[model samples]
Target: MSTFDEKLKLFAVDLYKINAIKFGEYKTKVGLITPVYCDLRVIVSYPQLLNTLAELIIEYIKKMQTFDIVCGVPYTALPIATVVSVKNSIPMVMRRKEAKDYGTKKLIEGQFKEGDNCLIVEDVVTSGSSILETVKDLKNSGIKCSDAIVLLNREQGGEKLLSENGIKMHALLSLTQLMQFLKEANCVNESVVEKVKIYLQNTQVDPNVLIKNNRLKLSFLERLNFAKNPVTRRLLQVMCDKKTTLCVAADVTSTTDLLNLAEQTGPHICLFKTHIDIVEDFHPNFLKHLKEIAERHNFIIFEDRKFADIGNTVQLQYSKSMYQISSWANLVTAHSVMGKGILEGIQQSEGLKDRGVFLLAEASCAGSLTDQSYVDATLKLAKQYPDLITGIVCQNPLLLEEPGVIQLTPGVHLESVGDRLAQQYNSPETVVLEKGADVAVVGRAITKSADPAAEAVKYKEVLWAAYEKRIASQ
Candidate 1:
């Protein structure tokens, strides 16, 4: 390998020797399940090893970038910072996790004054919460900290979190690098390697540190088109006109009953969702009547096709399908796993500006595989085509509520009862009042009720009240 690789390997080997990297089934202090646990605190026990680690950190920081002062993130990073400051002749700041009332009563202990930029140095990172909080305190003190350097990145959400928050992080080695070095050294078995890989794949943000906003950031142009998108604009209009934030999910399997259901429920709903393929006897003629009813009733049709294929195939499926979905459906749902190409295919339709897609960002199941990676992918796609991605079908309202994108939630029930399947049900109030969802999609709650229209009205009342309360609270 080259010099850089050599140093990385050396650092990994050194970390292993210190028992800083342990192989076993253990839960991190932050509750991250992993086959390997990292605690660089062990380095301070051996004087020579501690100095070696400090030198490594110093070298890594110097090679990565420059800073006006070095700030250690409390207890674990203080020793390393001391050595780096003494060796490199750099100024340093120490931040205490809690300020002592008897002492200077200062949260920060250092000679560096306000306006001096600092490079945050940490031994290892899991969620980067401490770093973020420290950065917050540093900023509060008027000191600038724009970059951070960590010895080991657990491949967790920390690096991304810091970067998103405007602070860049440079790591000497990642979990993948260290794991590979250990495997090559014959320090871990095949099972250990597999466990670590699995853990890393399923690893999500620790709930406490998961950063999110109440809504999405919409561009001025997208915001202007917010009222132009037929589906979203109509929904907002329904909220304004009818004072409701509920969308009736008419998932019946018959075209005639589907039309009847839309006509019956349209007065109270802004959108009517359907699973077109499930309709027992579907035809192009069926859509002709459906569109007429939709126009007369002032509601949009959302085809829950969940198109999961490639671009060309999905485009054909959307445009040339027997039902002629592209011509009739106002909005369509697509899985984000297929990436942007799937949506790109649907966007290639004749009415590009008029149509939009709801990317399924979250699954309403008990133990779904969807995680931060999936949510991030969905957000990336939505941000790419803000106008086209009208909204997201997600349960995490805190992060998914972008300005123009509506939050379409499913598995809603008037009562707490759920189906025999794994699908979970949330109350309309829970989803809207608390979670910030713009629209609650009710299926059996409305369709199977004694009175579907009355049920629709009930959901509209609760959801609209919750929407008003949420807005008032905000």
Candidate 2:
């Protein structure tokens, strides 16, 4: 029910309490005397705690989609995987270290197909040798293992070893997170916390090198350099949360009218999209005033010029033109048809440092080439100049389902044949619910209404209702 960060905070606090009561100097199965230990086995005894944790895991997996088949690695992970599978309505699998002579003489005991993308779940990984062996067995059994989810990572070579074997380690809690949790809960002394921090720091590993050595599959960010930017990531998040974002595509006919519409709808929206060439009297003063209003009301001014010119020409239009896009707009929409060189020019401009360049993908308007040649071009540009791009402008807001691209859908309305006007576009509610539209851009519905503020409120309420419904369903 809570946000990811909130759930993690609560888990840290609870885990700290459990650890304090159970941990002390003890001989581990690995034959090492440890001052602190975690027996998440205790969580099984506390049904409420176990349920909460299962719910959290389900929520996280649903959001991340990091795994295809959820397979627990041996004993401790089996219970956690079972609970999570029941909560999320997904099937579970278990991996055994060695084949049992009595039962089926099988090491992997579950329904799984060859090359199924499987995620191994574990309670904790210390040396990681056991999990590596488990991974080897799974791979030998024709299951593709690329990811591992664990309760805690001790910040040791375990993560590196797993990664070296082509597996990513996703942990709900790390040693650092646990140490901080213990300190906040007053379950451990400052000296013990310091020792843990020092131990983790000294044993830190580089994930990039490990990933390379294993010839593992690259993550979304690694595949597309554009996704590494923080601005791009934030824009993607805005697009994903169907409630707070409204993707608008208005013809820039009059600055005053556009500004008025933005003010009326801005409070409930995240992006106010525009086509700068359509504006009648575009000037620096008008641009400055519009930017001011956009900031005041908590929305981004997205210039939808769709510039498809040479590098020099695009740079001039962005900085020296009457609109002065670099000065006013938080994000500028551009056509990647001009090649990566033009995108490089846009990025080289100092004034456009914080500005995001949303690439034109599947255009909202009909008779556009986005479906055929444009889509391929956009994908290539997205890979080539990912650092300069922010998001993608498309009618299929569902494309925003990707981790890095913000899906901006225009032509949204509460009621109008406007849906007929753009035969394929979705209504505001439909866009939010079914299409996963981050921002619903409405034009005539709000700006042309008798009472713009009231109309905007109606749209906002509808968006919120859709958001609540989706969250409830989840």
Number of the top lDDT candidate: 1
Candidate 2 positional error at 340, Å = 1.4
Clashing pairs in 2: 226-386, 245-439, 246-439, 246-440, 247-439, 247-440, 247-441, 248-441, 252-278, 252-279
Candidate 1: count the clashes: 3
Window of ten residues with lowest summed lDDT in model 2:
212-221
Give the TM-score comparing model 1 with the true structure, all chains together.
0.55
lDDT of each: 0.76, 0.66
For all candidates, the clash counts are 3, 10
Off by over 4 Å in 2: 1-227, 230-243, 248-252, 397-401, 419-424, 471-474
Please give, for residues 377-398, the per-residue lDDT of candidate 2 as tens digits: 7866776765666666665433
